[model samples]
Structures are given as structure tokens and as C-alpha cells.
Target: MAKDKKGTKKADSSASARMSNKDYLRELRRLHVEIVKLQEWVKNKGIKICIVFEGRDGAGKGGTIKALTERVSPRIFRVVALPAPTDREKSQMYVQRYLPHLPAAGEVVIFDRSWYNRAGVERVMGFCTQEQVVGFLKAIPLVERAIVESGVILLKYWLEVSPQEQTRRLEARIKDGRKIWKLTAMDLKSYSRWYDYSRARDDMFKATDTGHAPWLVADSNDKRRARLNIITDLLSRISYEEVPREKVKLPKRQAPGGYREPNYPLKRIAEKF
Candidate 1:
């Protein structure tokens, strides 16, 4: 990933050109096969893995997570996207709400947005005190160190999108019926506070980018390239070899001797498509 003078990562060169749907799907399906192998390896080896994805709105975090887990078993590769904290949750330790969602033995947990909320949204917005944000920045590294010590492999990714691209995507969401649900009031507010978010992100990377759990920056202006790059990088980090399985043979179906088909008519919904 390349960064400009501002220290913000620039989108990949490949993002300049649009990716055809055919090529995207072809490569995506190929990676999906590898993800299935990784899933099997994790389960067979009882590996504990946690992946944290944090980024600006419309930065393609959801899409990337969807691609990563779509072909894998949900039970083994779980996604945790916590909603706004309740009053009770707010009162607990800042990291406490996230701890319970950590990966157990043989499981991989992917957090759509993890505790770094204190560093990004919570701090940039008025949700948390500056002191609290500062405290979290100092303390989170220790928490992550403990997580790694407990035999869990932690990976953090920050998806970076240019300001123009982000605005375009946000506007597209407003017009696209399927994406309307993704555009929230908070997102609208966050849009205007770009510089605030940038400063917060810089401060966050400075404080929490530790030796144990460093941040991996992914340029998401071109979503297809970003997805492929992320998945490829992730797979490289985890040392997994495809686990051999006994060949599965479908047993022949038994013939129903003297069984008569029912002639009863049932109402069916008209096919709209």
C-alpha cells in the first residue's frame, strides 16, 4: 500500500480501471475455494483466529466480510457486528462488550467494527470524552497482547477510500433501494467530519499499531481489487494446507416399491418473476 505526503494511504493503481463482473467473479470463486480449505484447516487444527475490520462508511467492509465468509461454515467463521451499545453495555468496561465475542478454539471471529470505535467514531463524534478515547488508545494494545498470548491470531484491517470515492458511494446508497438501509443519520453526520475522522485514524494508528497486532491498510476505492487483495493477504498470514478428506460417495436412493404418488392438489403462490 502506498501513502501520499499526508500519510493517508492511496488507493491501489488497479482501482483506476473498472473491473469486469466476469473477471471479478472468476477470481472470487477461485479464492472461495481456498477459504473453504482454510476453514477446514482451522477446524482440524483447533486454531483460534480473530479478524477486525474497521473503516469509513461505504468503504466495503461489509462486502469484504461477506465474500470471506459466504462459502465457509457460519459456525466456524462467525461475524460479529455489534449494534450501538445499550445503556448497560456502555457502563461496562470499554473492551468488555467485545471480549465475549472473541474466537474460541477452532473458530474464526470477524468483527465488522471492533473496540477501535473509541478511536474513530466515538472520539470523532461527541459520544465519548477525549480522556476516554486517549485512555482506550493507551490500554487497547495491552488487551490485544493478552489476546495473542492466549493463542489467538489477531488480524486488523483498515480499509481506506478517497474522499471523492466515499462521497460517491454514500450518494449511490441513497439512490439504490437495496442500499438505503446502509445509509444512517450517523453516517450522514460522519460524512461532513472527514478531517476529524482522518486525524482520529492517524492518532489511532500511532497509538495502537503494536508489534503484536499491527494494522493492515487496504485501499477500497476499487472494491473488487480490495476484496481480492484482502483475501489473498489474509490467506497468506494463516499457514494452512488443505486437509485431505475421505471421498464422499452419495449412496443410491432406495426404490419405493408399490408406493403410489398422492394426487391431492395444493395451492401454490403465483411466480412473480
Candidate 2:
């Protein structure tokens, strides 16, 4: 063991430099496997659940969703990513559309951004009337309390990024050929009202944060860290009796078919490029 001049112990200094996203992807895949296992574990318990993800633009909310649901059974896991309300949707009661997307027994529903748009974007941008904004703020805690009382697991995540990071990521998206379209009118609103949005976001946390449904803040400055952190936090929230590893029944093999000889031996191709 060695010590620095200041008497700090030099501990485990041989590790590799910061890992690439590839490492993070592998870890996320492993966590997704656990989430699938959790669904079966919670099945008999009938624990309906929702994990709502919200954040500034370019905070990797969609990427986090990919990691969370990649291994979960599609039939049991649902993701909702809707656009701005249409004329038809605007006519209906606001919460009505979201009702159809809620989780069923043993199911998990992930909302890319749930109903909180009212408290954040709609408020800052004046999209919602002040009265409507107030209404959403007042109803949030009450509605969440009722949902929690119903034995549903509600985990909310707020993926936050520093303003500088936001600008960098947004600019990078513009330069990145594939992501230019991500800089949309709505996102432009967010960046323009960065301070206003921050205040509005704080209001959101204060208004809806309760013992029943608390906001899990995800430091989203780094995409890989955010993905890994969010998935692990969600898994910690759920409790299941046991996953039905034994219940996975494999079909019996067909009666031993007569062996057929291969027409050719396996061959390796050599590349000389």
C-alpha cells in the first residue's frame, strides 16, 4: 500500500479509464432481465404499477425507457409516448386519455411524460389557462393519493440536467445528422424559458411530491449513468414474493427424429480486405 504526500491512501488505482456506453448497455440489459423476473414475482400479488419519466429535452428519457423495457414481456409492459393533444383529445377531459394506458394486474406501464406537463410546460408557455393550471396542481396530490391507496406502485422520476449540459446536448443533437429533428418547437420553448421552466419544475415537485408519490430525481448529465441509476431505483421500489423461475415450462422435444446427415461440413470464410 502507498500513500500520497498529503497522507491520502492510493487505493485501487489500476482500474480502466471511464467505461464506454457499451458497458452501460450490458448493465442495463441485465437489469431489464430482473424487471421481467419481477413481473412474475409480483403477479400473484396483483401489484399494478406505473413508472413515470419526465425531464428536460435531450435528457435521454426515451433511452432510459428502452433499457427498462427491453427484456420485459411486451404483453405485460407498455410504453406511452403521445404527442401534443389533438383537437379531439383537447375536447375530452384531460385525464381521460391517460386512463386507457394504466397498468393491469401484473403489468407495468411507463409514461414518457405523464400528466405533469400542465405544471411545467403548459404553465410556463401559457398553453393552459391559469385556472386549468391551478386545477392540475390541486388535483395531482389527491389523484396520486387515491392511486396509491389502490395498491398500485407509482414511481416518478425527474431527470434533471444542468443548463450548460442542456445546451451542449441540444447543440450536439443539431450537429448529429440523425438527431436534428429532436430540436422541435416544444423543445425550443423549454430552452428559451430555461429559468421559467426551472421554477415551474420546482413548483411541480413541491405540489405533487407526497409520501405516496415522491419524485426520484435522476441526475441526467450523463446518459449512461442516468439509465443505470433510474432502472436500479425502480427495481428497488418493487417487492415481490418470488419470481416463478420454475413456472417457465419448456415444451417437450419432438420424439427423437431420425438423424439427418449434413450436406456439407462447416466452413469458415476468410476475409482478405
Candidate 3:
């Protein structure tokens, strides 16, 4: 590994140059193959996995998740991105809404944004009281401990982005039509209250960063590198091997004896392409 101008060790020499699309795709494909192997091992061994991804907006969590699951079976690897709690949910225990979505046997549940909302957005935006946030932080370790003790493999990731890069990403979202949906009024508010969010994050880490389920922080200034690094680290952490399988050959097609094309006219859409 070589050092970048920032003095951080680059994952590879390619970081010195504009990492070409070709290299990105090639590396992604290699990782996708390993992900497939992990998926198979999980299903075959009835391994339960729960992966939590949390970060500031535009920290590349969604893109990293897409790269992880694009080549894997959705049945085995499930993504849970819960929306704001409903009225009933608000009345329930803070963690109650998230409890039902945890991984079952032979399943991998990935939370795009998870229970840490109380520690981050909710507390910063006044959705949760200071006392409630404190209580949740204190109780979260017990909840996570139970999950891990119940034979579940839990991994929590917090993607860290520099304020400058965060600003550039949010500004790009404002200009790019395709990404406009990602920019919300709340985001603008959060952008202005960066230090407030920082304080909240520090508090959350102090309380909930436990040995049972420790938080893994990833630097996400470079989206491509961040995705690859996260995926590589995830694969390395999990203990899995390629499950053996028997080869299959395609059977010969059945011969058509009396089947004939229907005479009835049917409407078909024009193919402009």
C-alpha cells in the first residue's frame, strides 16, 4: 500500500490516479463472487447475520449496500430500510419496532439505517427528548447482547465522511436531477447543525459502543474505495468457506407433438429500440 498526499495509506496504488471504471468493475466482480460463496455458506449452515449501516446523509451507505447484494440472492440477503415510526410505533418501546426485523436462521438482515436514529437524527432534531436518547443508549447494549447471545452474527458500521466532502455531495445532489430526491429539507437542517450531530454521535459511541457488538468505522471520502474496503473487511470478519455442490446438466427439451400456435390475434407493443 502507498500513502496518499493526505498521509493515509491508500488501499492500492490506483488511488494515486483516477481509479478507472474498468478497475472498479473488475474488483467489484471479484468481491461479488466471494459474496455469493458467503451467501451459500450461510444458507447451508443456517447462519444468522445482522449487518447495521449508519452514517451521515450522502456517506455512500446505499451504494455500498447495492454493490454487496447486486449479485446475491435477495431471499438469503435481505435489506431493511425502515421509514419514520408511525403513531403506534412511537407509542411502543423505542427498540420494539426494530426487533421484528432481526435476522432469522439462514438469513442475513442488513439495516440501511437502524435503531441508532434515536442517537443521531431524532436527538439532534428534537424528535426525541434528551432523557429518552440517554435511556435508549443505556438499554441498547443489553438488546444487542441478547441478539449476539442468541447465535446471531451482528456487525455495526458507521461510515465517516469529512465535512468538505459531505458539502460537495449535498451540493451535487441539489444540481443533479437524478439525485434530487435524496436532498430533503431535513438534510439542509442537518447540514447546518453539523456540530450538534457530532456531539450526539460522540454521546452514542460512548454509551453503546460495547464489546459484544462493537461499531466499525469506515472512512468514506472516496465512494469506490469505501465500498470495496467495507465489503472486503466484512468478508474477512465472517468465517465461511465455499460450500461443495454437485454439477448439473440441462435436460433435453420435450418434443412438440400436437401443440400448435394459437390463431387468435393478440395486441403487442411496438419496440422503439
Q: TM-scores, in order shown? A: 0.93, 0.81, 0.91
lDDT of 2 at 259: 77
**Which residue pairs show backbone clashes in model 3?**
none
Stretches of model 1 off by over 4 angstroms after superposition: 1-16, 263-265
Candidate 3 to native Cα RMSD, angstroms: 4.5
Residue 47, model 1: lDDT of: 96
For residues 24-122, could you state the per-residue lDDT of candidate 1 as single tens digits? Answer: 999999999999999999999999999999999999999999989999999999999999999999999999999999999999999999999999999
Q: In terms of TM-score, which candidate is strongest?
A: 1
Residue 54 deviation, candidate 1, in Å? 0.5
lDDT string, candidate 3, 151-215, tens digits:
99999999999898899999999999999999999999999998998998899889988998999
lDDT of residue 219 for candidate 2: 85
* Candidate order, lDDT descending: 1, 3, 2
- The alpha-carbon deviation from the true structure for residue 100 of candidate 1, after best TM-score superposition, in angstroms, is 0.7
- Report the C-alpha lDDT of model 2 over 1-273, residue by residue, as the tens digit: 568999987764422333477898788778867776787876667779988999888888988898777776777778988788999999998777887888888788899998888888888889889899878888888888887787778999999988877898899988999988878877887788888988888888888888999999998877788788888888887765554455668898887588787788778799898
**What clash count goes with each model?**
0, 0, 0
Better of 1 and 2 by lDDT: 1
Clashes of 3: 0
Q: Tell how far residue 256 is off in model 1, in angstroms.
A: 0.7
Candidate topping lDDT: 1
